[model samples]
Target: MPRYLISFEKDAMDHIREEDFPEVTKAASAVCQEAEDAGVFVFSDGLSYDDGDVEHAVVAVDGMVTDGPYPESKELIGGIFVVDVPTREAALEWAAKVAVACRCAQDVRKFRGPAGV
Candidate 1:
């Protein structure tokens, strides 16, 4: 089975009021449960909302480690779901369910096999 990544942008949750988070979370959790029940779920997790808390590391050519959010991305990953499925269409279907559950758009990508095979 091929694994697909389903992810959401960080800014999408910025406008959600604290009080409403529980409901939104409930909906999203339900989707995760569904994925598990279907046996397609590999892993799922959410990122911390505080960007300041994130430590980005860069490994130099000589293996020196530097810390910072490199590449200066305008968007951050809010959450992610790794699902192993049979086809791209199946992945897209899962993404759609996730988007609705999360109340935000989702970005889907297929994982490259080992050694890019």
Candidate 2:
């Protein structure tokens, strides 16, 4: 088994209206529950992107702290699921389910090194 991260960018869900969040949350939660039932889910969470979170992210360089993200990057992980799957194909299949549930595209990548499989 290998661990994979299935995630989406914050902006990827920007097109969704606030009123639709409940439904989207419900659908996404259902998928998470399904994964849990299958014993593939290790963790799942939605990251906060509010002014107090992303806007206030700190970067440290040579012991000096800097505010905000790297100047070259604007995308942020909106949500993620850490799953222990048997193969890349299985990870992709899970990502597909997450994409449909969240109504957005997803990015999947395996954890590096031993992955604690």
Candidate 3:
């Protein structure tokens, strides 16, 4: 089974009202549940950087550690769902559901397997 990544940009949720988080979470969870029921769920999680609270964020090079992402990205992934499905179309369908549930557009990409395998 091939896995696909389904995610949304962080800025996509910026305009969403804080009070609406509960409803959004509920809706998103339902989609996740549906995926689980279909046996395609690998894993899913949301980033807590919304309030600028990037838990344990750090950068390290040559044993030196710094508190930052070397080069800031204009678009950061807000949440991700990895699903093991048989086809791209199935993955896109899941992404579509995720987009509607999260009230944001979703990005989909297939995962590469072990090198040369």
Candidate 4:
């Protein structure tokens, strides 16, 4: 089995209003449940984009400690699921389901180098 990361950028969900979040959450949760029942789900979570979290990011270089994510990339990982599936097609199918549930595009990529490879 190969592991794939199905993810989306934070801005992808920006169009979703706070009032509509519950519906979106329900849809996304359904997809996660489907994946779990299908035995493909390994782990998944949505990253926090709160200003406090980002502002407090610790950066260390040569024992020097600093705060904040250096370079400050415009995009951030909004959500991700690690799934162990039989093939790329299977992963894509899962991604499609997720995209529909989240109402956003998904990026899918396989993990590097299988065990002992």
Candidate 5:
């Protein structure tokens, strides 16, 4: 089986409202459960809003640490799922399910295996 990353992309701050978030969260969790039942789910998690809350770190040549969100972008990786599937087509199907569940766009990509068999 191959591992694939199903990433959900969207403007993190747009859809999250304090009042509506709970319902949305419940729905998302239900979808996750469905994936788990399907035996293709390995792991899944959602990221926090792209506010300054994220602790960013950068490594310098001398191993010094610098901080901040790498660069700014219009969209942020809101969530991701690591799934084990037999083929790319399977991964895409899983991504579609996630997209519909999250009510957002999902990007699926097969993960590269470790160097040298």
Candidate 6:
């Protein structure tokens, strides 16, 4: 089986409202359950923006540690899921379900491991 990553992209400033989040969460949970039943879901989770209490540190060229997102942008990865599936088609189906649940653009890509020397 191959592992695939399904990522949601959204603007941090234009965050989803708390009231609307539950519905999305419910939908996502349902999809996750479906995947689990099919024995494909490995893990899934939503993430907060990389700001405030989300401590981040960056090392500069001179070995100076800086704090914050590097080259910050309006959009950030909001959530993701890692699933083990037998084929790309299966992974794509999962991604479609996730997109409908999250109500956002979902990017699906095959995860890579360490390069063979």
Query: How much is 58 displaced in model 3, in angstroms?
Result: 4.8
Instruction: Go through the candidates in order and give the clash count of each.
Output: 0, 0, 0, 0, 0, 0
Candidate 3: which pairs clash?
A: none
Quantify all predictions' global Cα lDDT against the true fold. 0.87, 0.89, 0.87, 0.87, 0.77, 0.80
Q: Evaluated with lDDT, which candidate comes out highest? A: 2
Better of 3 and 6 by lDDT: 3
Regarding TM-score, does 2 or 4 come out ahead? 2
Show where candidate 2 strays beyond 4 Å: 54-56, 115-117
Ranking under lDDT, best-scoring first? 2, 4, 3, 1, 6, 5
Instruction: Note the residue pairs that clash in candidate 6.
Output: none
Candidate 3 has a TM-score of 0.86
RMSD of 1: 1.9
User: What TM-score number comes out for model 5?
Assistant: 0.78
Off by over 4 Å in 3: 50-61
Expressed as tens digits, the lDDT of each residue in 3-117 for candidate 5 is 9999977464366677877777787788778878988779999876556754646566899776754455455677898889999998888888777667677888888877785
TM-score of each: 0.86, 0.87, 0.86, 0.86, 0.78, 0.78
What does candidate 6's lDDT look like per residue over 1-117, in tens digits?
889998877452146687988898899999999999999989998665544744556677999877655665555666888899988898999999988888776788997755782
> What is candidate 5's local distance difference test score?
0.77
Question: Where does candidate 5 stray beyond 4 Å?
Answer: 10-13, 16-18, 50-54, 72-75
Best by TM-score: 2
Residue pairs with backbone atoms closer than 3 Å in model 5 (clashes): none
lDDT at residue 92 of model 6 (Cα atoms)? 90
Location of the lowest summed lDDT over 10 successive residues in candidate 4 = 52-61
Per-residue C-alpha lDDT of model 3 across residues 2-117, encoded as one tens digit per residue: 99999998678777899998999999999999999999999999876645555635555666766444555567788999999999999999999999989999999998977887
lDDT value for candidate 3? 0.87
